[model samples]
Target: MINLKISEPNPRESVREYAYRILSENILDLVLVPGAAISEKEISDVLSISRTPVREAFIRLSQEGLLEILPQRGTYVSKIDTEQIAEFKFLRITLEQAVMKLACSDFPQKLQEQLCNCLEKQSICVKKRNHEQFFIFDNMMHDIIFTGCEKSYIWKIIQEANLNYARARVLDLSSRQDEIEVLFAQHKEIVKAIITKDTSLGENIIVRHINKVISDVDDLQKQYPEFFK
Candidate 1:
């Protein structure tokens, strides 16, 4: 049986939106593992809501390639697509490297402080072996960079198209906790590059940091053969 955390909908959020958000988050977090069978009725019952919203949410997720619906079979969480992951990685590296270069030129002081605070928390999470929180802050740090560079919309675009890459990253971090410190160090270098206005260094670190997952794809697929396409 699937166990989903039930929560009240956010203010002004439609039931359909709420369902989509919750289900998509679970799918991304790997709580709803890849290729796991699911159903609209099952999700609706789990969330204590009617099936209509859940069905609508399922449709949206399917459009995003996060859910697969069969005419006679059942709904299943989609497997991570390696080809899509590579494409998204290429998109992210291209856009983010540009953003990092812009950030090095003129990142706001307030955002820079926020990045420092996020890194401090990330450091603590690393010390406590908290890969989950580290992952959260890892994304937060990059978001800050985009926001500082005034490219927030690009960040949103990347995120909207990043489902597979995001899941793959979570898998990588969860399966290989030992690499967390190395990631943390690279993050520090990224921040240092931005603060010191080193555009070349910033670009290099961003590419390397983002590509780290691509480099590990072979091993990840080997370990979790069922999770990928």
Candidate 2:
């Protein structure tokens, strides 16, 4: 049996939107796991919604490269694409390195504090072995940096373009629990560099931080070959 925790639909959300949101969140969070079989009828039955809305949601996720609709074989969650992951990593490294430089020059003090708070939450999540919340706070910290540098739109672009990269990250965190502390330490150093206006340090940290996953891709593939394309 599929173990989906169905959320109540929001008052203003249409059935389709609600279905899409829940399904997408589950996919990104790896609850649906890459390459797992999924069907509109099954999801509709699970969510207690009409098949029409569920079908629509599946089509949308398919367009976003989150679902593979095989003609006769049936639909399944999309596997992680390492090529796309490497592409997005390059894009992120280039743009975020520049953002780090800008942040070092004049990041807002308010945002700086928020980054520290995010780090503290991440620390707690690490201690508790809460990979999900740790991932959330990790993204939140980076979002704060982009907001502080007045480049939030750029951050949004990265988020939208990096879904595959995001899944790869979640996979890494879920599989390699031991690395959480190392990631937390890197985030701390990133915040420190910004606070002290250390552009050189901040830029270097961003590169290393973003490239860590790519460095592990070979090992990750060998360990979970089916999860990757």
Candidate 3:
């Protein structure tokens, strides 16, 4: 189990925001596993805050479908819903393809440089066996593509909608740590396609790259059944 550190609440940020950020990070880090019971009082006590703020945080996470606040039982990390995962995958792919199509046509030099830097950073992450850093760099590369297309809004929606898929990707990353090289290769191809302004090439590469992020859902579901519904 990962140890969670409670951060000091910033005066500029409300207690609920602070609690929410901390709790969200912890949950994503799996310090609070799915279906694990959590109480507003315990959280408030631990964070040295009042119950109201903790309660508010719980409400927000629940709204995000990341938590389940039972009426009388208690609040718990929500189990991953595979149906939602599939739905998000479809929605994400559609919007991303549109974004990539624009990016393929525009193919700005600035974004290409950014992507090259991300690819280099991702390569270093692979060498260091740093899954977390690899994931961060991966997102940055994709975000740069979105920026190139002037569609960061779509990227934000994709991020907000794919929490379960994100965690599942993390699990897949752990099992296939060596697969980072292949992922980096795919990223390189996408970048090259974009740099050369090859629309069809970019389309093929980007779809394959994005789909690879969730291709092993069945295996992952089998491995981490408790984390899923």
Candidate 4:
């Protein structure tokens, strides 16, 4: 097992959620790759916790289809399911598109300020070549949109549905440099649409934004055949 060190568990974060966040990020980043054996004891030991929380994390990952827990064979990272990718991408895009439509009409000034700040931070991350931070800010921007529409529950479901999307995003960031460069500009455009209450423009941009991954899957499959199913 690779050496793992997590930050001191946050007081507000339940053990299981902390463990889940650490393991989930590693899995998504391809550090703990598909088909690799994962030991609950090892992880719990790293986190300086009992096996219970690690096991809880394992159960959650299994439910999200990010890990396969076999009774006799031991737990291993699950191969990326392209089908799940398609389904969840469709679901997320649909939800976000709806959110944009709702949020665009009378888009609150405070939320607009938050989104613009997010976009600015995203621009900085992209310029600094900090792909990880860029991804984090990207999600924050979207979550703000969802929250603006009073659909926080929808954002939770999107997060749960995003295992494959997360992995694919890593690939997307690594490979699509030119388009990634444009993403900040695109984010600005999205915010502009919202500020002006232009739902049609927002929808159009979001569709292209969300579909970029699906459009590039062939290249992803060619690059990492083993990661895909």
Off by over 4 Å in 2: none
Across residues 120-168, which tens digit of lDDT does each residue of candidate 1 receive? 9999999998887898999899889999988998898888999999998
Clashes in each model (backbone N, CA, C under 3 Å)? Answer: 0, 0, 0, 0
C-alpha TM-scores of all predictions: 0.97, 0.97, 0.91, 0.90
Which candidate do you rate higher for lDDT, 1 or 4? Answer: 1
lDDT of 3 by residue, 43-68 (tens): 87778789998888999999998899
| Model 4 alpha-carbon drift over 4 Å, by segment | 12-14
> For candidate 4, lDDT tens digit of each residue in 110-190?
988999899889888877888878888988998998888888888988887788888887777877777567677778888
Off by over 4 Å in 1: none
Q: Model 4 shows how many backbone clashes? A: 0
Pairs with backbone N, CA or C atoms under 3 Å apart (clashes), candidate 4: none
List model 2 lDDT by residue over 24-62, tens digit each.
Answer: 999999999899999888898899889999999999999
Model 4 earns a TM-score of: 0.90
User: Which is the leading candidate under lDDT?
Assistant: 2
* Stronger candidate by TM-score (1 vs 4): 1
Error of 3 at 200 (Å): 1.9
After superposition, candidate 3 runs with Cα above 4 Å error? 5-11
Q: Evaluate model 2: give its TM-score.
A: 0.97
